[model samples]
Target: MDKSYLDNLKFPASFFEDEVREGFLVTSMMKRYWASQLKVLSFVVQICDKYNLKWYAEYGTLLGTVRHGGYIPWDDDFDICMMRDDWNRFFEVAKKELPESFQVLTLSNNEEYEELIGRVVNCNVIDFGPEHMEKYYGCPYTVGIDLFPLDGIYPDEDKEKDRVARTRKVLKALTLAELADVNNHELYLLLKEIEKENKVVLPLNDKLKNKLRLLAERLYSECDVTECGNVALMPFYIPNNDHIFPRKLYEDIVELPFENVYLNVNARYDELLDLEYGDFLRVNKSGGVHEYPVYSGQESILAEHIGRNPYRYTLDANELLRSVQRYIMRMTRTVDKDTLPNAESMAGGSCADSGAVIKKKAVFLPCKAKWWKTMEPLWKKYMDDPGYEVHVLSIFYYDSDYNGNIGERHDERALFPEYVQVEDCEKFDFETIHPEVIVTQVPYDGFSTFMTVHEFFYSGNLQHFTDELIYIPYFEADAPIEKGDKAWTALSVMVEQEAVVNADKVIVSSDAMRSFYVDKMIELCGDETRMYWEQKVESFEKSAETEDDSGRINNEDDKSDMNAWNQFLGKYAGRKTIIYYITIAFLLRDTGKSIGKIRRALDTFSDSGDKVCAIIVPQEQILNDLANIDEALWKQFTDLVEKIKTTDNCIYDEKGFSLGYMDKWSGYYGDASPLVRKCVQAGIPVMIENIDI
Candidate 1:
């Protein structure tokens, strides 16, 4: 390889002499370690660039770049920093894009690894030390790069000083807590006193470390650095020794060569580096070279000790590390035999183990007949699962004035086998069931059985007893169907937002549907809620087999009527069939304007002699509104209906036949409806009244 890159650097003779003395094994190991870290660095840099995230080389990594033109020759770690915004964004993007072998470690994510900074760990290779063995035990120790969040400091001098002081205090308390082991009675008593005074409980473990890290980051990020003139290198290694710099040093970023790739670095590196390390160029012989006990190719050792493949738990870094620690402690007898917790105890010995009585209760509530039809297959799956006791409940109360008359309690007994118990929510003892998983079609707090189910579950009241609130948001209403008054539309939006926010998991019909909800959730709720929902929300395209078959209607009577209607339309087979379906709410409220528009369009089609037959199916709601219509408007509507009925090429299907079965027909012409999407999906042409011809 080319050694020309190292020619400019004036290394002391001792450095090469020490390398020679250590032999080829140590030198080769160091080279491999550096190479691995560089690979990680490249991976991270590529992701940041793809996501448009700003990051810069920092600390020892930056020092190495400036002093050695690459890794410090002895250095084994890489460090980088991003502003809090960029840092958060990087993690969000990196979680999905990072290679399978690479794992992202953070304070919140990995319990055993306690640090304010995050790490991108390479699981393919093992790199651990004596300290790692002691702390991480059975965990798979891997090569990783550190990622620090550069937080903004308060512009106000006094406020900044106060913030730093408070952070230092928290850090001190955390350190003391860690040091206060079971043997250190005096230290433990001192920590207790400190905790009582500060009103901060300090547990000497991962929890305390996490709390302190959060506290420090929060305190540091209190002020907006972009708005302010200063920034702080927060969660710094030393307490009370925060390195504050002018925000200008961070604003202008420049790319610098580090190994084979270029890295983003603060433009004002001279000033920043000088502030960080006084006389940075003058390398102290003692401090310049640092070494740590690194164990290479210890994957087998980790796997053998942990009693499981270390790589399997890479995604769950915290648990992986904890397992490692526990295994090491068990092997070395470092932990007291009487005090040490058992595997069962550490594993929570609850629902995790097999053969444990699976008390998982799942309740599926179908608010409407259509919803029941859509979710029936899912109900059967849950029924088949021995682990789950599934309760299928239906609420059969419908408003007679609005939803037509509901008769016979809508029995679902015939749909399922005798083993399945289909109960009515009105009569069912929901309190006794005590369901852990609530699966509902009506996810919102709206004027539906959703409210009734919510009441039954005591949802959003008292303690949240339900474990998983799964919402199957199958219906996609892109725009408000309501005319004039937007109150109903607003209410619908609110309900959807509530469902998006509160539901533990949202099952969407398609990826398009998922994206729509994701955008809507983000718009309704902030970024944090959006992030939560993104993780929880998933897409499962409805099976074609589950969809209502073509020509199938709700009941036998409706089916016969639709068949007869189809037979009637068959007489006009020579003509192009145009299925005109419109909501009456829009028709009546538009003062006959919508109908007039349709009339004109139809007249034009007739005049053109295009051999087109129009089938106008008005919504049931429109038929109901006819009773309230004034004489003049009523006459106008009837005249239009009469004209269409009398016209040789037109037929009125009054029952408003199921749109799903309209595939045998030619095209759709009406106001935009959710059914239009279905028509498009079925390869039927759509012509909206005003928008499309």
Candidate 2:
């Protein structure tokens, strides 16, 4: 590379004097440091590009671009700022994309490094610190660039000041807490003094950093950025000035050349520069008054000279590099031949050597084991046809007990054939596996990976991911709601409304469901978008032939092969069976009354002894909520069921034996349930409790 870029830059006389005193080459050191910074910036830019996150140059980096067309002669650090949302998104993507050479340091990740702003540090080289700064001295320190998050500020001046003041105090306390761990008594004492001076008590503890982080988040997110007049870098801790700038100045980005690479900067760079540094174009005399830390090319040499490396506690570079490489390869690698169409054709221009049209890629994300029944038919339809390639990513282990500690659900896995490929949520990579169409049953925030999809087909709730959105409304029973169930009901209604409003095409099982969702959309969004919602929603009746046996049959010959449901059914031979279903809502409301009614009804039927059996099935939610029920009510309900089970013709199957075993029953009697709709469609009579048959 040419060294000509550094030739024309003027250096202060003190710069050379300091280099002689510190025993390092001033010009060569700055050049090396600048190169290292550019490397980190390049890696950051690469990550942003891969993940579609936006970032811009800020502070010293921006100042250097306009005033010097590169690094300021005296400045050694690089700075970048992103809107709060982009900043968070970058961190999420960086978790997988950042190379080993770099480490993103924040208060949460490295408390000892204790700065509100995040830093992307180069791990390859160490910076030798000044002797007086005992904390950083003898530490292996890397040259790093600051990444400040610009958060929305309150529109009112007084509110903005109050927010800044509160955030600053928390930042001070957090810094002190970190210092306390390092045995920096003076700084800790200073924090106590500040607290005493302000007539408040702030504890120096481990939670200080998290408390500060939460406060900062609230300051940024409490107000809407677009509506607010100004945005500020809340954690910068600048005195007198709040560091707030006009929102317009930072909203749009423009490209500017820094060193050999072009980087994004605020569109109104002139105003931003002037606000931060008055007369920014003028070079400061007296060496700019900023401390310049000595840099070393070799880690061991710096370590030996300083007695220890300060950054040893930071992230491991080699491990991070390997992880980054794996992530990149996984993202760019060709899709497996079994799961996709021609790999070469998908990568290159055409679909096949025959010059046929390319097959589109579609992915299905089922949130639970039960959802597979709804999505599998569509998956098979596409899998059999050559016009499309299909893949399944399921959150099968979402049952509360299995969450966070996921184990193989062998039963759920058996639902798919060996030829079909299914990936669990934890292992699925959204960036690497690009799908043209995405079908999802649940729109919970847990499946954030689906946000990257181009064409989204939501079977239930709505998500704000794509314009090419398709909504498929599923059947959900409207059970009687108690006072505590109102929030759950409201959220369910909101999710459905959002799905209808954003849907480009809405598919429902019946005209009644279509009309119901349409009215909901109009209620939530008003009549202005009613025509659009009405035109998009259409009913698609489920095919009669598509219904499969509700329960998985085990015919392995061994006595142990029989499931509990089959074992329970085996007890009754040549008897007419009626299956009854119940939900958590039914149990939680009028607990004593509902149980009493059930007991009386079962006892009345048992007296006849007409060679009939009644099987009860409770949903999983009801079983799980058993622990939360009032102790008195739970005991009464359990005792009632026990008493009812004594009846010769009644069998209380509390383990939900009859849920998917409707095929084994002669008739159905239950509160309105999703299964009721299916049974009614299959020409089976359903006697709903509290409603006319």
lDDT for predicted candidate 2 compared with the true structure: 0.54
Q: Give the TM-score of candidate 1.
A: 0.36
| Deviation from truth (RMSD, Å), model 2 | 27.2
Task: List all candidate RMSDs to the true structure.
Answer: 30.0, 27.2
Alpha-carbon runs more than 4 Å astray in model 1: 1-26, 124-141, 181-206, 237-242, 288-693
Which candidate number maximizes lDDT? 1
Which candidate leads the pack in TM-score? 1
lDDT per residue (tens digit) for residues 361-462 in model 1: 888876655445546556666787888888777644322111122223344444433344677566755567657678766543322211123344332320
lDDT of 2 by residue, 1-693 (tens): 112222133222122111211111223234545655665677787787777777878877787776555665446778888877777778776756877656777655665665567788766455443431122212334666788887777778797677666556655655666556724676566556555544555455665556555555555455666668777776543335557788777655556546555667664565676677766544442233333433434544665676643322112334334433433444355345356766576677644565777667776666444445555556666788887877676544322110122223322554543445777555655446555556665432222211212122332222233223344432232221232132222223323333344344656555755665566555545677567557666765545554553224233422343354456766665577887775444454455466666666677668847677887776554544444545675677677677767777777787665655555577787654445545654567777664211
